[model samples]
Target: MNRFNIVYYTDPLCCWSWAFESTLRQLREYLKDDCEIRYCMGGMLASWNTYQDTLLMVTRPAQMGPVWMQVRQVTGAKLNERIWHFDPPASSYPACIAVKCMGRQSKNAEEEYLYRLRKAVMLEEKNIAKPEVLLQLAEALDKEAPGLFDLPLFKQQLTDETTINAFKADLNERKERNISRFPSLWISTQEDERKSLLITGNRPFEALQTLIHQF
Candidate 1:
């Protein structure tokens, strides 16, 4: 079978990306052995310090309520809105870096870590910005995941020179592409990587399915 490669650009803390999880699962099942989904962590929120300057602290979480409501209506994915106030993340960078670190182990580990990170933020409402939380999540997952992710190495890599550089590189790629949205999909065949399709924002599963075929 011909291999289909897709670069999925998303953030772990993105509400819309959380909603798109079901669509991604469906795609995995649909594509089976024919596709490779490569994850590109788009650092959506660099820090709360950035948000504090523009929006002030109080109004930030308030703004997300309606947006998450819309996500619920469209994607039928549940979110704990209290997370915005209960234990909000300062930055999505930590989670993104963690995912990239897991990728060093294997794609399977990377994919599992991505989902676990997403769940921690969206459903469990944990503060994934904290290193302890990320490590805890990784520890819990290591028992069940196919390969044992080296905890000490993962911790070191989180802030290592190479890991930070990779994060910067991906962030730069997103900026160059001018992708201002989460849950974006860039689809192409291995034979012609340049000939691709870009799907931005949240769309229904049927829409994604159609694009998968069209691509």
Candidate 2:
């Protein structure tokens, strides 16, 4: 059987993607060694250049609180909306760059780091967009995962220009795919230019199973 390659386009700050975590984990476990999964960080909030007033950004929590409450009702995921009431992140680019830098350690490390970041934002309501918060996440993961991350090396990679560029490349790929939504999954073979399956928005495990079964 030929292995499938899956490109997951997501943003750390995206609640919809966070809600699909369970489904994604189940799909990965079911596929096991038969699939290759790559996570691409799509920049959710590039910047606030268009919005001049800081208050305009500050009021976002009000807008997001109700939305997250509805998401929790649907996905059954715990999300702390208080983070928005307090100090909200200005952009998701920093978190995206941090995840890209973590990839330098190992693929597993990158995935682990991304998972932690998402949990911090969605559950713990941590401001993962900050550099200090990101470094703290690295330390916590190092202690929790044990030998999964190299702190010194990870910090070094964080400052490397390539890491930032890699994140920008992901954003460009999102544009190329004409992806406007979070939690988009593109399944294809290495030998094929066409995608075998493309799923957009939050999806259930059954949707994934149905697509893979067709192959």
Candidate 3:
């Protein structure tokens, strides 16, 4: 059997990605040691000032509530749309950069932090763009898993040029690959890099399993 690699392109603030979390967990359990998954941050929203969604006509924060409601209705994911009305995040770049900072510590840290970030924004109604909130989440994670991250190092890397550049590379990769949606996956067997598949949008576990098997 050939091992596989999946490069998941997602944004921390993306509701669709949050909805797909359960399926992602199931996929990991099914693949186990046979697959290696890497996360690539897609800067979904740099700032509201420059944001525009012609398809949804979402030019302001309040308009995002309906989008989240639609995602919840379709995917059955727990989400609080009130955040968009009350405390919407101005940008997703901070959380994305924070995940990259966590990656400097360990892959586990990066994955765990990303999960927490999604949960915070989608379910907990937390504004993840704030530095204080990001640090608080990191502290909570540290309490849960001892030595998972170096507090000082993680904090330092939050504003480090290298970490920012790493996230920029991910954005560049997404642009180069023409990936405009969250939860986009690029999967390929270790033996043949040229032969690969790209899956986009939220999908059911059975659908994903069948697709991976066919690939």
Give TM per candidate: 0.90, 0.91, 0.97
User: Candidate 3: where are CA atoms >4 Å away?
Assistant: none
**Model 1 Cα displacement at 180 (Å)?**
0.9
Tens digits of per-residue lDDT, candidate 1, 1-215, equal: 44688889999888889888888888878888788888888998886556532332233655565667767886789987777766667788988888888888778888888888888877887889999999999889867763567777787787788888877888998999888788999888887888788899788878878876775
Please count the clashing residue pairs in each candidate, in the order shown: 0, 0, 0
Once fitted onto the true fold, the runs of candidate 2 whose alpha carbons sit more than 4 angstroms away are 49-59, 191-195
Model 2 TM-score, 2 decimals: 0.91
The residue-level lDDT of candidate 1 at 65 comes to 57
How many angstroms is residue 21 displaced in model 3 relative to the true structure, after the best TM-score fit? 0.3
For candidate 3, write residues 1-215 as lDDT tens digits.
56899999999999999999989999999999999999999999999999998978899999999999999898888999999988999999999999999998899999999999999999899999999999999999999998988988898889989999999999999999999888998999988988799999898889888888886
Off by over 4 Å in 1: 51-59
Instruction: Give the Å error, residue 181, model 2.
Output: 0.7
- The per-model lDDT (C-alpha) reads 0.81, 0.84, 0.93
lDDT of 2 at 195: 47
After aligning candidate 2 to the native by TM-score, how far in Å is the CA of 117 from where it should be?
0.5
Candidate 3: clashing pairs of residues: none
